[model samples]
Target: MSTPLIPLTLLLILTAVLVESQSIIPIRYDGFVYKKRAASTGTVLIEAFYDPVCPDSRDSWAPLKQAVDYYGTNVVSLIVHTFPLPYHDNAFVTSRALHIVNDLNVSATYHLLDAFFKHQEQFYNAQTLGMSREAVLDQVIGFASSTLGNSFKSAIKSGFNDSKTGTKTRVSFKYGCSRGVYGTPFFFVNGFLVPFNDDDTIDYNGWRKLIDPLITKKQHYPSNIF
Candidate 1:
């Protein structure tokens, strides 16, 4: 008697779930800010959706870091959102490792990122072909602990599936998806996605041209010019 109603009810429930998900927003703290700006008024936000094991992301990281370092944290707030690509064998483990680092020791977040970039090849598909996920996770944990410390190692032993760190990692990836990022090394500046084109592949000089004008404009021109 209720078979027809059951199918219609399921459809309505699924639609409501999607609507709720759409209403959710990504918060600023969803990603760990590597270079923090003290104030928001004139700060330029440089956000990266990066896969830790992705080669393109590794290449993009250097110039991005250099640019942010040159600009100083005062002017640029660089936030790295780890968008772990599924095809990468151990990217999720490494991505979760970052959230764990950010959770336990916010200051060592960059150190963990550097460690991952430094040893990226080890976690590649060929290298980790026969390795189980737990083994890869162990390797990641040890690597992170080495970069951070024994104390962090203790905390992170179970942090991957722990509520807070796991949720943070998941949220960062979800936020990247919601922003329409389909690949590693995607970037956003001031909440606007950087369009795909020749200039999208940015170098230090490229970033300077992009950032300098904005800085100068903010300094000289008043906000709300109209």
Candidate 2:
């Protein structure tokens, strides 16, 4: 005997329920996740893909920090991903050190980033500058040591060789690559890629323009949610 079919309405409802269950997207707190001062339900996530030695990335630092300071956690959250460019010989090593710093202390990671960008010239090797690779690596590690204390020196050294750190760094780089990030200082605001022109400045106004609309759009809850 053939089985009886369910009602059309019931079948549609079941399909809708299955789709909704599968569509639930989890919040990813990967990389150096920096939350705002006061997080709320409507906080927009900003994913930044940058390289420590990239000048454009360095230029983006102030504006990004300014946006967080202005909006706070109530409006936005920032996730920093290290996408060390292959051309920069010392960038990979620097990124590995940063990953360790991020794991040890999130706050100190910010300081280390600032230090790397501010004194980028000191860490450049022969590929970008006249310094040797050893000297550059030493400078980067020493900077981390100074910023995070000497006790962290051994951990940082071990992190450089640790396969886990390498895996994390590679994963971050691949994540950005999969999302069409070909250059440093690439940004995704709430999963919407922000179109950036090389000549255009990524200042507070630029960021505010992109972010304000998203925040405003998020304020309106779905009508279906009863």
TM per candidate: 0.84, 0.78
Worst 10 residues of 2 by lDDT: 21-30
- Give the Cα lDDT of each candidate: 0.77, 0.73
Candidate 1: segments with Cα more than 4 A from true spot: 1-20, 23-28, 196-200, 224-226
**Candidate 1 lDDT, tens digit per residue, 1-226?**
0011235664564455455546666565578777445535568888888889988788778888888889865788788889887678788888988888777778888888987888899989999899888788888888888878887888888787687777677677767666766577888888898765632467888888888998887788777865
Clash pairs for candidate 2:
none
Q: Could you tell me which residue pairs clash in candidate 1?
A: none
Q: What is the lDDT of residue 38 in candidate 1?
A: 55
Total clashing pairs in model 1: 0
lDDT of 1: 0.77
